[model samples]
Target: MIGTALRGIFTLPDLRKRVLITFALLAVSRIGFWITVPGVNYDVIEEIAGRQAGTWIDFIGIVTGGRLTNASIFSLGVMPYISASIIFTMLVKLVPSLERLQKEGPQGYRKIQQYERYATVLICIIQSSFIVAWMTSVTAGNERLVPNATFSFRLMAIVSMTAGTVFLMWLGEQITEFGIGNGISLLIMNGIVARMPGKFSMFISNIARAVRQGVNPAKEVTELAIFVLLFVGIVAFVVLITQGQRRIPVQQQKQTRGRRVYGGMRYYLPLRVNQGGVMPIIFAQAILMLPIAIISSIPGLQSIRFWFNYGTFWYIFAYVLLILFFEYFWTALVFNPIEMANQLQEHGNFIPGIRPGRRTAEMLEYILNRVALAGGTFVAFIAIVPQIVSSLMGYDIFLATILGGTGILIVVGVALEFVQRVEAQLLAREYEGFMRKPMRGR
Candidate 1:
């Protein structure tokens, strides 16, 4: 496998360059994770964060690739950009003007993208300001997170963080254009994955400590084995679901004109089982975290914090329900059977055993609805189970995240997408490229 990958990497000059560029850019991003924001004490922030582990802060830190906890310049990460894009996306669906612009083809698409960029900057300013304010207010047993709480210091911090986020967004775009994969997704995945080595080390150290304390090493080893097995299984499951699709058969009518005949063929339109991909989970996480962020900020909500506390039964229950809801909601937005059927009918195609119009549309919707229900449930279970297990085991939240169902799904989904792109490039160049058979007779 390693040799094959290396050969593939070196096969094309452009691919090799793209892969190199992606790694270099990611390295720069990781460096930014350690560069702290001015005026903040790392120890105090760490202490506060540790005490508040498993809260919204922890989730944000994971998403930012550990930047938020470090109080770095890139603390905001690509979240502001994601939030901005989502806002614009929702607006485009709801507002007629934006919808029209969206349908206007390339020029219109560029205009919307420009609007998204503007909105991203605006969101960056707002989110950065709030982050700065929140950081300034953090205290660890009377030690201020930011020692010098001055207007100039706050302004600098905000500007630095916002600029860092904007730069990261630019880096992601560059990676998409000139690198190997989906840049933004890779950035977020990098953040989630960057902590893996430390997590493994922690687990090893914990086992050593347990053995030193006369605990049964056998039990611990067994638990570790189970954890590894579960992680692999979940990754495999996610990969399967991410790649799974339902192919609807379509038969085209034959056309004959004089000496020419056309359009007699059968093909299938593939509708993925998990059409919404990770968006449903992302949306659900953001929504669930919002309340935690708000309550963390407002002291008056302290009394009710117990109910909303991370790892609590209520929290997990709510999280699962929300994920399920968003899965269906997002699926609806992205898939419309009626429109699909109309287009197919207009092209003189029909699904076998189903009427060409409304009936086919209904059948498609029925199949989609059933598949979506099962997929949504599976995703929700995958997301919640790891959190529940980690909380019970008292292990590192970071480890839980990687071992957690959602993280594995994202990693598998993104990795598969990257591989598919590589395969497509290879296939395109093949014969003339790789996977070609020799001609039998010239």
Candidate 2:
């Protein structure tokens, strides 16, 4: 099945071209990963990053495809754009003027996009400035990452990093216009995947060290097996939840013209179980990082940082609540029951045993709230399980994270989306899809 899918993908000229363009653009993004910001000693930065493993920098590395560790020009990655979009999304829901603009259709959408771009630039500047300050301040063994903590160095770093992000944003747009899949998501997923081989090597070394120390190699092997099983089990569960949906049947009104019936048909609307998808997790993670950042910056607050530590009980509790909150918050903003009801009425279609206008809208809202709750609970569980495992098993947080947390979800989600996209293209060309065969066995 996999070989046939690959053959089908390469055989189609348009699809192949799009795929190639996507790879080329992603390669360009990766180039920035190796190009560090000037005036910084990367060796010192790398050592500090190693000592502070599993901190915010590592988390940033995970998000940006491992560029933060090197303090590269593209260290900011596509996060600023994502943050801007999320902010605008919230504003559109809260501000009546933006809401009105949103209802104006394509022209309104374009306007909103322009606003988002402006917001992205602003965010990039602010974040890059903070990074400059942090890098200049951090030192290791009398050696500083930024040797010269001058205003000129700060200015140069800010402009270079921000430009790198803007270029990445443009590259993502190009991929969206001329390539395949979502460009921003593809970049993130690419970064996460690029780190996998190194992570796998670390996993092996961890096991080998335990055995060499006579710390019961059999127990270590059992743990490895458990991790594998847990990873696979979680991935399977995520895929099921991600793809799960409820199909609401609708009946179209029949019309007669010259004794020929037209329009009478039954179709179903698919309401995804996980409506917010991965955004809720992203929002929750961003909000949860605030406490650590605050504690680290303040002198007296260092003692209380453990309360907000990643594996602490209070931290997990707060993280889960935040995830649940954002799940519902995002769902409410994007899914409009009233709008859907109106569209159904205009099309002369109605759900069976339900009225067309207000009642149908109410029903949809009720269903959405219930499904959103389930999704929120599932994601929250997935997010924290790895932390709990790491705390209990005394394993590295990075390893546990890749095997269990948002990283796997994003990776699996992107892979599924890419496959579905290729299958769609194949079907559009009247070719057998990845899972569909031309002939059936009797």
Compare the candidates by TM-score and give the number of the best one. 2
**Ten-residue region with minimum lDDT total, candidate 2:** 433-442
Model 1 CA lDDT for position 323: 79
- For 1-442, candidate 1 gives per-residue lDDT tens digits of 4355457677788888988899899888889888998888877866875676666677776654546767899888888888877788778878999989989999998899888888888988898888888888888887889999899998899889888988899999999999988998888888878767766676577689898999978876777787788778778777777788888888998899998999889999887888777677777887767777677678787655678666677878887888778888887777888988999899999998899899999999998888788778878877776676676876555567776555667677778777766656655554122333322232
lDDT string, candidate 2, 73-174, tens digits: 989888899889888988998899999999999999989999999999999999999889889888899898899889999999999999989999899899
Q: Report the alpha-carbon TM-score of model 1 versus the true structure.
A: 0.90
* C-alpha positional error of residue 27 in candidate 1 after TM-score superposition, expressed in Å: 0.9
Best by lDDT: 2
TM-score of each: 0.90, 0.92
Q: Clashes in each model (backbone N, CA, C under 3 Å)? A: 2, 0
